[model samples]
Target: MPRTTGIRALIRPLRQALRRRISRWITRCCGTPHPRTGPLPAPGRILVCQSNSRLGNTLLLIPLLQGLADRYPHARIDVVIKGCVHGSLLQSLPGIGHVHELPARGAAPRAMLKLIRELRRLHYDLAVEANSLSTTNRILLAGCGASHRLGFAGPDQCLRLTHAVALPSVASHSALQLLHLLTALPGRAPASQPTLAVYPDAPTRARAETRLRRALGSIPANRPVIGFFTRATGNKQLPNAWWQQWRAALHAGGDPPLLIEIVPPGGLPVHADQAAVSTTDLMELAALLARLDVFVSADCGPMHLAAAAGIPVVGLFRATPASRFAPLGNDCISLDEPLHPVVVARETVWRYDRRRDTRRSA
Candidate 1:
């Protein structure tokens, strides 16, 4: 029985390999073909697949989904999300149609096959695999029975996609590049800037405002709500001396500081009258964020969330290239600097960033 189990495991891997090899051979020989629906008729249905690695990555996908809908207004756009929670996020986000829950990970062979069968029954006109091309993604796209498959590919992986967008350098923001792929297709070119829309309930907004009021009691509201996100990769937080200097600067300028932190239900180092909240719940976070006039954060998920919410953001970026992570909005500011022999001030924020050229007019 033990030997039989071992043999069975080996057979499964071998079978997968053989299937992959066959799929590749077919793609290389015949070349991946576009949808054969005769002409440029409107697609019946479209599926956008999610296999992104991070929260910011997933958030960036919003515009691409919007662009797809804009281009194919008649088509029912469905998103295959990686989890039930992920599907819920997509459902809450604007510009989404149907949200199909995918496994928390990649679909198993049997599961994938079943999904393909279900998709076939729906008669999808196109499937856009919006992830890095792997043997699995290639197989999934080829096997899904969609007439068209689109993806970004390099010189080596070009053949696997029916229509491949030229993958840009890693320095470029993946979100912007993804938008290009949608626009560069056979339809109308995409808009100049992609935007995300969110509508927070009034009560939630009020609650968030009440919390902020308690945190910054008697502080002038117009004094540039300079939020400090004191966490980053490997403790890029502001030291006591830095805070001391910050306090000195603010006091000299008649401004007050409002320190934000995660508290119970998420993380806690609770203190009195502090505007603490959880990051785990989007609704709670959204409420807290809606109350902020301006937000400052590290190059983390919260930063992207703030940008998506159309809030003015200032991001302190280190290690990662700011190009890929910077919030591309007029109100958002990205400051790229190494955590060093510390020099931090309002001036320091502007000095470190090349993008901060358009100074706030006096």
Candidate 2:
């Protein structure tokens, strides 16, 4: 056993060294010239590389897109995304010219090659790598054939970018980090409040309304519709018991808001007592959230979606930091520390009532 352990330890260092050497070689071959200080040229075709498949990561690009639109009003912005669902979401937003969907999983060498050819043909004036410091994305930016490439400069990856900006010492919000990609450009104003915006078409909204009515009865105009998203991907999911307790507390409190549980497609069922509606389509989900008076969720994609829909959201953060991942907007409140179910219930009710009062006053 000791001999095996010693051999394993020796091999681990060897593997790391090999990885470092390969990384260095790739950087040397692909790295662009060091960044020059100057105002950006008028760009006609802009390519943004953000290939992460997670919904939150995709939604975070809204602010960056808005900023780019403001700075280069004439530029046709195209995005390279990983998942089709994210592409669909991006398609709904204004200012987006085209969405280039890359497969989130599995090998698609031919498809990728085709995509590269298409990108090269576009003759993009500027290519921005908006994801974290990733070598693969840097290589992809280099292949886009844009004379100007922008990205963050890590110790080993700075050479790959024509314009490399240093990341902030403290971790900033993901949206802010993405916006920083434009800092080197002249006359680029900072983006206004970073918020996700999803616009569902009439048919999609009608479908969502019909589904909600079928699942949770007709909505009463006077009653506040409260929506809850109890499931999240990975370890970010809250326990069923926790949700049950929260529901019970809400019911026990004074007149409870009309509760609707948003169950993601293929997600675990909510408690039988809670009204649940499940949908696979992101735009359909956004449509439903838009109709709600208040939405409560953990730090997840849907939480950001609800915020985008302009619904009041009480975002609960357990594993993730509230500062970096919390839903943004005036109507949103992020609670990071553990709180009693009754306290959460009370806060939910208060927020609902406050909005109600404001609407009446207005």
Candidate 2 has a TM-score of 0.90
lDDT per residue for candidate 2 within 208-312, as digits (tens), equals 999889877977766788899887866577787887888888888567778999886765557866778898888999899888888988899999989888888
* Candidate 1 residue pairs that clash: none
Q: Which ten residues in a row have the lowest lDDT in candidate 2?
A: 30-39
Report RMSD for candidate 1. 6.8
Clashes of 1: 0
Q: In model 2, which regions exceed 4 Å deviation? A: 1-36, 266-268
Q: Clashes per prediction?
A: 0, 0
Stretches of candidate 1 above 4 Å error? 1-27, 30-39, 106-114, 133-136, 158-160, 201-252, 262-265, 269-274, 339-362
RMSD of each: 6.8, 3.6
> TM-scores, in order shown?
0.73, 0.90
Q: Could you tell me which 10 consecutive residues in candidate 1 have the lowest summed lDDT?
A: 351-360
Top model number, lDDT: 2
lDDT of 2: 0.80
